[model samples]
Target chain A: SQKIEQNSEALNIQEGKTATLTCNYTNYSPAYLQWYRQDPGRGPVFLLLIRENEKEKRKERLKVTFDTTLKQSLFHITASQPADSATYLCAAMNNAGNMLTFGGGTRLMVKP
Target chain B: NAGVTQTPKFRILKIGQSMTLQCAQDMNHNYMYWYRQDPGMGLKLIYYSVGAGITDKGEVPNGYNVSRSTTEDFPLRLELAAPSQTSVYFCASSYSTGAKTQYFGPGTRLLVL
Candidate 1:
């Protein structure tokens, strides 16, 4: 069976610090990995996407890294703020772009 | 644009009941999908539509049905709802080509009593 795992621990950090989240997968080789941010009582919003061949991709305060060999992806939020507190999800999908397999999100709490 | 919207933000249904979760997107995205999220679990795909008329089953499709009659609407129907059907249902839409970023609706919370 295919599986994706996250830290499962709530991360707490002060504002202006960098937060890193990990996602690991088993049994499936995906061509692209994506990250999403979900706030309370709301749907998830797209954050960033990193292709299998790409080592890193960045958008403003967010960055994503995909390591195909390790079957892992890392999500990072730099200079985070209280408004950045939310659950971050990692999803993987193959080249066909059909369905995505998601990992249980990691909750982040940024204290001011 | 209103983006993606789902109706009946919350509902309670008895066993063997039937209901339809409505989803409409104003973004005119070609790809639409239905997903269910259980407590502490990741989002599980129930069904997806590539276009206005094409639909396919995803990882979990049992006890659920969906139809895509137009580009803006994709409704999921639940027949004979069971206890296992209790979950949060979300509707999403995305552009078909190149780096598909999905926009999700607020979601419908269903509790089967």
Candidate 2:
């Protein structure tokens, strides 16, 4: 069976530091990977997407790297702030390009 | 633009009861999807529609039915709700598949007793 896994443990960091989150998957080959930020009682918002052919993608203070060989993806938030505290989800689009497999997600808390 | 919207922000239902969860998108997207998130778990796709009158089962579609009579609306129907059906349901849309960014709605929280 295909599976996606995240740390599941909450990550705490001081404001202005960098936060890194990991997503690992098995038994699946994806065309692309995406990151999303979800707040309490709200829907997830699109963050960044990196294609299989691309090594990394960045948007402002956020960056994402995809390693198809390792079947893993890393999401980074630089200059993190208190407002960056939320659950970050990692999703991979299946090779068919019709569905997405999502990891449980890691919660990040930035303390000022 | 009201990217996507779901009705009945929250609801509680008795076992065996039935209800419909409504979702609408004004962005004129070609793809719409329904997903359910359980506590501490990632979202699970229930069903998806490629266009009006075109619906297909996704990762988890049992106990749920959906209809897309119009491009702007997709509603999920729950028949004989079960305890396992308690979850936070989300509706999302994207202009197209394969790397397109999906816009999600606030979500609808449902509790089955």
Candidate 3:
């Protein structure tokens, strides 16, 4: 079975600083990977998606890096704000391209 | 667009009881999915539909049932609910598979006592 792992501990960072989150997977070579932000009691919202051939993708203040060789993806938030505090989830497309397998999200707290 | 909507924001059911979680999307997506999220765990796919009348089991579908009778609706049915079925359910839909962004619903929280 494919396994996705993210940092289980909460990441605390000061506002205006950069917050980086890690996601690692094994047993599958996904064609694409995605990142989502989830607030409490709400569903996850899409953030960014990076394909296997793309090493990095940027949108506003968010950036995602995919390393197929390492089977890892890094999510970064630049100039973080208090409102950016939320759980970050990482997911990868299944080999069949029909579904996604998500990692146990990493909670990020941007303190002002 | 309404995006995705789920009914019964929260519900508590007794063991062995049955209930259905409703999900609807106005985006006219071809793919819809049902997932359960437990505390400190990642979302587990229960069932998914490629289109109307085409459904398939996901990673976890032992105690759940789903039907996609229309393009806009995909309901999850829990028969003989157990404590293990207690979790937050989320419905999501995408335009198509392979790199399409998924829009999620507010979610339905279920508790089995």
Candidate 4:
């Protein structure tokens, strides 16, 4: 069966630190991978997307790396702040890149 | 643009009852999708439409129905709501390209008793 996994445990870090999250998948070769940020009691918002041919993508202080050979992706938030605290989700295309399958998400808390 | 919007932010339904969860988007996107999220689980696709009048079943489509009559409106119908149907429902829209980013609505919290 196909599976996607994110860090199950919550991550805590002080402000101005770098926070890293991981996503791993099996049995699916996606054309692209996406990251999303979701706050409590709210819907997810798109963050970044990395294509299979791209090794890294960055926007401001956020960065994402996709390693197709290892079936893994890493999300990073540099100089994190309290406002950046939220659950981050990783999603990948399935069924030939038409549908999306998401991981459970990793909760991140940045303390002031 | 309001992006994607879903009506009835919350609903409580009795088992066997039927109701429709409404979703609309103003982005003029050609692709729309419906998903359900259970506690501590990832979002599960219920159904999706590439364009008006064209729909397809997704990973978990049982007990739910959806119709896309217009480009801006896609409503999910729950026939005989079951306890298993209790979950947070989200509506999303994206461009015609399958790899494009999706924008999601706030979602509807449904409780079946």
The model with the greatest TM-score is 3
Q: For candidate 4, give the lDDT of residue A109.
A: 96
Tens digit per residue, CA lDDT, model 3, A1-112: 8999999999999999999999999999988899999999999999899999999999999999999888899999999999999999999888888898899999999999
RMSD of 3: 0.9
Interface RMSD, all candidates in order, equals 1.1, 0.7, 0.6, 0.8
Q: lDDT for each of the candidates? A: 0.90, 0.93, 0.94, 0.93
Model 2, residue pairs in steric clash = none
Superior candidate under lDDT, 2 versus 3? 3
lDDT of 2: 0.93
**Native contact fraction, candidates in order:** 0.72, 0.88, 0.88, 0.72
Per-residue lDDT tens digits of candidate 2, residues A62-84? 99999888989999999999999
Clashing pairs in 4: none
- Best lDDT goes to which candidate? 3
Candidate 1 per-residue lDDT, tens place, A35-100, comes to 998887789898888877899999999988888888899898999999999999998764467777
In model 2, what lDDT does residue B76 have? 98
lDDT of 3: 0.94
Error of 2 at A65 (Å): 1.0
| B80: Cα error in model 4, Å | 0.7
Q: Score the docking of each candidate (DockQ).
A: 0.77, 0.89, 0.90, 0.81
Docking class of 1: medium
- Give the range of the ten consecutive residues with the poorest summed lDDT in model 2 chain B: B94-103
Report the Cα RMSD per candidate.
Answer: 1.5, 1.1, 0.9, 1.1
